[model samples]
Target: MKAFLILEDGTVFTGTSIGSAREAVSEIVFNTSMTGYLEVLTDPSYAGQAVVMTYPLIGNYGICYDDMESARPWPDGFIVRELSRLPSNFRCEDTIQNFLEKNDIPGISGIDTRALTKILREKGTMNGMITTREYEDLEEPISRIKAYSVKGVVKATSCKEKYVLEPEDSKLQEPVRRVALLDLGAKKNIARSLVERGCEVTVYPCDTPAEEILASCPDGIMLSNGPGDPKENTEIIREIRKLYESDTPIFAICLGHQLMALATGADTFKLKYGHRGGNHPVKDLETGRVYISSQNHGYAVDPESLDPSVAVPAFVNVNDKTNEGLKYTGKNIFTVQYHPEACPGPLDSGYLFDRFMKMMGGNE
Candidate 1:
């Protein structure tokens, strides 16, 4: 069926429908990864957005359930240049069309994705609608798109209950370092990464109190990546402040990184077009070495707002010189604005997870 993608700016792109026939309106953003469409679809960080895959061809390898980062797909909708009908991977279990249909994700294919990405890049990210319904007048859809905002997404995407994950069998006999992970819509790999490194990970909902987490006597605390503006989570920030006051080792990623900055009096601002790709390069200030990293966040911590006595910028994006990571002064805390788990991206920055383990005094 014919589908229309109506942008907030009154621009419309018509294409064949690939997913559900239902309508979807969301903040439209683009990702540059050539592969990992499955991971992108299931990532909790995409909760409130409709993703435009810049890669021309998608689902050639098909969907592998094992590669999913969350229990379900989180994007409001999907957009692509072309959809592969016949996947040829040995691990392929389902076609992208079937996955989207089963998950009720609306998508558009055969559109000029490059042009769409260019618009988002030049004009910054904007709201858009995907629908199979034909509209002679674009005024109403554009207005609705403009009024839409991504809110309450953290709670919507977060786990409903706390759960524990034991270390991998290889690390089972080793001394287990307990980690309290505050799941601000965490990707499953975050817990799996810690579990692989001999840590007993207790995953908690985003709204869990600091006192309750502290009472568990965990050796370390972890703040996870999520969706939306970091400043909107005032209660989570307050709890994070309490966590900061404690001497326990702490590590944060993406949204967590932004919240830690806010909790410590630093400010955050949305990017003109946020980083949402696998090949972003970041330079480690201490080592003067750069690593290609996986990233997916719309907001960044303001370096100028940080007090040197509290924390300092640790890593920076090579593309825009934006803050990529922070190192707290006089505290065993470090945070990065990129994903170290690298579900669908490069593994260069995976060492940061080991660094977190080290911070907790765990043996390598």
Candidate 2:
């Protein structure tokens, strides 16, 4: 089936429908990852947005049950240059199109993805409309695009209830290490990573009270990445502040990093276009080493806005000089403005997960 992608600026690109035959409107953004399409599709960070893959030829590895970041795919729609019809992998159970079809998500393929990526890069991200067939007057779609908002995206994509994905039945006799995870639209993989390391994870909603969390007798706390403005999520800061009363170790990523800074009396602000790719370069201050990381956020923690006495800058973006990570001098809290889980690309920061595990007194 034929499809058309219309940008907010009246730019249109024709393509072929590859997934479910449906029309939708969303903020269009591009990612530079060459693999891990399953993780990208399931990541809640892409909620309320239509993702355009810069790398051509997606779905080569096929879809498996293990790589999902969330319970379901969150992108309003997906766009790519090509979708492989026949997938080749031992662990593959289904094709990309089948997965999207099962989830009622729409997608467009056979378009000029390189051009689309370039446009987003030069013009910043913009709202876009994807239709299975062309329409006569583009006014309605354009109007819808203008009115689109991702403010409550985290709530929409978040897990309505909690569940667990443990590694195996190996360490049943050991003391159950506890980690309180604040699910600000958290990804399943992060929780799985902690569980795999033998920690009994208790996932909580974004607004869960600090008193209740601490009452659970947690050895550590984790802040999750999510969508929307960090400043607007003031309630999370209040929760973090209450957590700071104890000596429990705390770790945060992406939006969680932003909230951690805000909780420490720092501030956060929006970026011009934000970083949404998988090849962002971040430099660690203590180690003096640069690591390629996966990032997906539109707001960053302002180092200058931080209370100088409370938190110190721990990392910086090598390309844009933006603040990337922070560490509390008086407490055991630390955060990074990027994805260290490496869902789609460079695993340089995967060690950070192990660091968190070690902090919680679990064997790495």
Candidate 3:
């Protein structure tokens, strides 16, 4: 089927539908990652956006079940320059096109993805619509795109119910560490990381109350990554403020990082186009070591808004010098804007999980 990606700014690019034929309206952004399209699609952080892959060729390696970050795809749509006719990989379960069809997600291929990426970089990301209709019939969608806003995206993507994940390797006789994870649309690997370290993980919904969480008597708390503006979640911020006030060790990632900052009276602002790839270079301020990381968030904590006496920068992005991580003074709390679970990319910052383990252990 034929399709056209129409931006709110009156830009239109014609292309062919490669997957589901359904139309999609979303905040269109571009990703520069050369591989791991499957991970990109399933990441909850992309819940309200449509992705344009700048790598030119996608689905070359096929999709693998192990590469999925969440239960299903999150991106409203996909744009790629080329779709591999035959995906070749040892662990390939199915082709990307088939996966998209199964998940009811739309995709467009055979377009100039590089040009689209350049447009986003120069003009900043904007709302867009992917439709099978001709350009002449795009008036309604254009109006729709202009009025579209991502609201309640985090609540929509978050888990509906809480669950527990025990250690993968139960043979170890070590003392089981109890960790309560506040799910703001968390990835599976975050829980896996805790389970692998012998921590019994209890994942709560985004709206889980602070009193209920503390009543569980957890050794530590983990705030997870999700979609949309952190400030819009006023209730979550209030709960986090209460959580931080107590002695329970807290570790936050992505959206969790932003919410925690807001809880501490700091501020956060959205990026121009946002960071959404696996090759972001981040430097640990404390160790002065650079590490390649996977990032997928549109907001960053404002360093100037933070109380210097209460919190300090732990890491920063080398490309833009934006704050990447924060360390709270006189508290067992820390947060990072990047993914440390590695997922489908570099594992340089995997030590952050170990640091969480130490925090939980020391508090015990």
Candidate 4:
């Protein structure tokens, strides 16, 4: 069936409908990754956004059950230049088309994705809709797009209740650290990553307070990534400030990183166009090393807004020279803006997770 994407600017790109017949409207963004479409779809971080894949060809490897970052797909809609109808990977058990249909998300293919990406780059990310409209006029869609806002996204995707998971049997030894993972729409891999390293992880919701979390007597705390503006999460930041005094060796990624900055008296601002891909390069200031990273964020910490006495730059993006990480002074706190648990990365960032373990005396 014929389908199209309508941007808030009244731009329309024609394409073919490939997923469910439902209509979707949300913030439109683009990703530059050439693979891992599965991971991108299942990542809770993409909630309330329609993703345009920059890579010309997608879904070539089909889908794997083990590759899901979350239990279900999160993107409101998907756009692609070409979707592989017959995936050839041996581990593949399902096709992207089927996955999209089952998850109630729409996918539109055969569009000029390169042109769309260019428009997003120039205008910054904006609202869009994927629909099989009855008419060609875009007035209604444009108006809806202009008024739409991605609010309450984290609450929608976060776990309703706390859950626990022991270390995986494949670990070298029994679990040592008990980690409190605050799931603000967190990806499953965040907990899996901790479990793999022999940490007993307890997942918590976004509304949970500092006193309640501290009662767990956790050896460490992980601020998991989520969707939306960091400054809007004022309460979480306030609780984080209280937790900071404990020097609990907190490790945060993506949204967590931003909240940590806000907790430490730093500020955050939205990017003109957010970074979303696997090939981004980052330089670690402390180690003086550069490594490829997997990233998905639209907000960043303002380097000038941070208090030098409270926190120091730990990592920075090589492309835009933006602050990518921070290390707190006189505290056991460190954070990164990229996903260290994302697979098919440089695999060098996982050491950050090890550093968290070491802080909790799990380095043995």
- Best model number under TM-score: 1
In candidate 4, which residue pairs get closer than 3 Å at backbone N, Cα or C atoms, i.e. clash? none
lDDT of 1 at 242: 100
lDDT of each: 0.94, 0.84, 0.89, 0.89
**Each model's number of backbone clashes?**
0, 1, 0, 0
Q: lDDT tens string, model 1, 1-364?
A: 9999999998899999988999999999999998899999999999999999999999999999999999999999999999999999999999999999999999999999999999999999999999999998888887888999999999999999999998877787356899999999999999988998889999999999999999999999999999999999999999999999999999999999999999999999999989999999999999999999999998999899999999999999999999999999999999999999998899898888889888888875
Write out the backbone clash pairs for model 2: 69-188
TM-score of structure candidate 2: 0.93
Ranking by lDDT: 1, 3, 4, 2
Which 10 residues in a row give candidate 2 its minimum summed lDDT? 164-173
What is the C-alpha lDDT profile of model 2 across 213-283, one tens digit per residue?
88888888988999877777777778888887679999999888887787778888877667877889999
Tens-place lDDT digits, model 3, residues 1-364 = 8888899988898889978888889999888788889988998888889999888899988999988999899999999999997998899999999998999999899888888888888888899988887866667778999998888888888889988887767523266889999999888889988887788999999999999999999989999999998999999999999999999999999999999999999999989899988899999998899999998888899999999877999999999999999999999999999999867568888888888888988322
- Per-residue lDDT, model 3, residue 312, is 92
User: Which portions of model 3 show Cα errors greater than 4 Å?
Assistant: 137-139, 169-173, 362-364
